[model samples]
Target: MNPGGLDYNYEDWTTIMNMTAKTSVLNLTQEEFIYPGNRACSGCGLSILYRIGLKALGRDCIFVVPPSCLTVMQGLFPIAATQMPVLNCTFASTAAIATGVRAAMKRLGRDTQVVAWAGDGGTSDIGIQALSGALERVEDIIYICYDNEAYMNTGVQRSGTTPQGTLTTTTPLSGKAEASKNIPAIIAAHNPAYLATCSASYPLDFHDKLLKAKEIKGLKYLHIQTPCPPGWGCEERMTVEIGRTAVETGLFDLYEIEDGQMKLSGPSQKLLGKTSLRPVREYLEMQVRFKALSDEQINVMQAEIDQKWAGYRDTF
Candidate 1:
């Protein structure tokens, strides 16, 4: 209760934020990240992750940003949200561009972390070839896919990451027969140094994983769960809460893999381990995608969730 007049201690709340707050002006002398003026929505969770990620990684980094919502949010030529050196590449060549940057950095004897940031549509679908090529070569890069579950920049079209029963431009309320692509396992199949899934709801887990990714030398991948208000048909303020609920309800699990071995990083895993699985409806109710779901369709979703959760639990 130092200054904010909260019940819990400030120290404890800081632990919750999982970000190193600049206690004084001296801390501000280091460097700035994720520039202040940009075009993100009022409560965009991806922006929150970008801010924290920049704080943790510092400015001694180069970004390989591709075409996506982040590209739009960061703005067109002459305006960018990130203060660090950003290399804008073609939509399907983010991984290839990142590999090139890493190789150039090594040749110049410069020690700088090269990160490739792309969207779900970019990584899981369009950029898969480039990503596979980079991973196969084991390039020194950190690839982070901010998965909003759809092609938000392209008018909320469905991507491989979009879950079933959702109402996207391509997959309307008629219901999608295909399942959401499992991106972590897809990357893990490449056997990179590190791979994980993160959400803003669990900031500490996110920070820890990023720190670990920085320590590793080879390719590191993080697939982050980001919620979009306009895309998901949810209120702006519920952005972070929606992410939290995704993990709590097991619609998305906070997980990681190292040298081919897998791990779960949050308390929800333990809770899920001991308790009976909750209804998928409990999770879907928060978003408008399921608004048109019939009782039969809801049952289909429930069965799918049960099977998926069982398989995930077995992996533990």
Candidate 2:
């Protein structure tokens, strides 16, 4: 049996290994699952990630979304942006709902994938209990948390995943005092079948990871760093650029862990042995949220990034 309590199949493992080859942008499917004219903001990073993600998941999937920006983006009632079926749940029950949906699918002899999509607040704060329970039970589902730093869905409040020194509405003057939660590390402890970190800037990378996760049984968790324009105080068009800068500066990484082994994805892989990464200040300067950050604070953040990469070098 796999770590997730599912019956292990050697052939399935081989197939998954063979499919790890990177997908090229040119070869991506032309099919679009999300229709045009949605409520998503201009240059919303989640929109980009969602569009590419659906292509990778295909039509044989059901989505469990909570009260988030995504719920607003998909429209209301009679109109919807996505072609697939979505069940909107409360802020704290995303994983529980997904588990129920997966159980129903199995009872009906259907192979449809169940996905739980939520923002950082919903995942790291409000919904973590359900997520942890699902992971521990080895529920068959894909749980995706798109971290935009703060709670953008409801007036930009501070969330558990919000980084230190970010100027969210709740942390107005002094910025956030506590460090951001390391959610992936927490999820890793549950020993899920698969886990990954993705960036909204790299759609194909996220797509490939989802495709890989789809073939695996039991729980798979993917945490993606998605940039928000109004919340982050950046121009709308710079969302993708800001997201890419996060990876280049070591603020965020792209990687996957399967069967207890971790591997860096392409963008971050190329950065492994580099002498230095782009300054974290460059990433900070791009966002208005960090406007009040002092030079000392920036230096401290840079040191933390350097120290992190040093550890990565030792491990990878």
Candidate 3:
């Protein structure tokens, strides 16, 4: 049962799931929350996700953003890009600040949804402790980590979530040695009321996931793979294509974990077997950041992806 005392039956779930059809574009609200002009780079994946996500979230929500690309995208102080209320917080205090915001709303007899928006560095590395605490306490908030792999806003530095063999300012010649941290798996271990993985290439899928999260109570965590044109060394116009290719190559999978149960969704659902996935090399070749990766390194990545899918096939 939802907080509103409404039961979300299996049929209702099916209806929501089926709404991802091409015609579902008509289902999105015409309302605009994010303004047209902003500081976002050309072909920014976050721009696409932000627009659709706000439409799904509507106006009855508050955003707690950390010091990241979004902070720059939203503009400084007197000037802003979004049409909603946003609280700018420190890099490592996003979730803690969001918790305080939620408490304030409840004290005022308001039920506004509190959302914490942060980048990969802020989430998987710096702010993880606070996030883990929030999840453990089952805080009534939505936390979204827009993973662009590196700390893009900070001169493309290597972050905990930066993929292995991907060149960054900190790891220029040989690229990062450590593999990207499995953030979704880490977050899933907390077992929040709702958890989902989304990609910027599929905005409608993300929109539907946000809508579903809004209906649920307790901690809700969403991780989105946002493509960075400048950071990833791809052409500005190739952002969407790169993001789509990431999923098609099985480097990233889209799915939801509701109350500890996991299920594949969107394009990833159609790609159940390893044979259905495209070559990981295809995805890597598109980005200049992977230029340093040797053929052997690429093969290692591909083998890892295949092994992952093999496990998924066995489980789901």
TM-scores of all models? 0.86, 0.93, 0.92
Question: Relative to the unseen true structure, what is the C-alpha lDDT of residue 151 in candidate 3, on a scale of 0 to 100?
Answer: 95
Candidate 3 C-alpha lDDT tens digits along 1-316:
1334444443453454456543155445556788889999999999998998887777888999999999989877788999889999998999999999999998999989999999999999999999999999899999999999999999899999999888999999999998889999999998899999999999988988988898899999999999999999999989989999999998899999986899999899889844668999999999999999999998988899999899999998
Q: Which lDDT tens digits does candidate 2 get at residues 94-213?
A: 999999999999999999999999999999999999999999999999999999988998989999999999999999998999999999999999999999999999988898899889
Q: List where candidate 1 sits over 4 angstroms from the true fold.
A: 1-32, 307-315
Q: Candidate 2 at residue 165, lDDT?
A: 91
Off by over 4 Å in 3: 1-23
Better of 1 and 3 by lDDT: 3
Worst 10 residues of 2 by lDDT: 1-10
* Local distance difference test, candidate 1: 0.79
Q: Per-residue lDDT for 1-316 in model 1, tens only? A: 1243334332353353345432222221123466677888878877877877775565678989998877867767777676778888999999999999998999999989998999999999999999999999999899999999998988998899988767888888675557789888889888999999999666556666776788898999999999998898899988888888777766677878887777777745664565466666776888886676788888876787678777776766
Candidate 1 worst ten-residue window by lDDT? 21-30
Better of 2 and 3 by lDDT: 2
Q: Against the unseen true structure, what C-alpha lDDT does each candidate score?
A: 0.79, 0.90, 0.89
Where is model 3 poorest over a 10-residue stretch in terms of lDDT?
A: 1-10
User: What is the TM-score (0 to 1) of candidate 3?
Assistant: 0.92
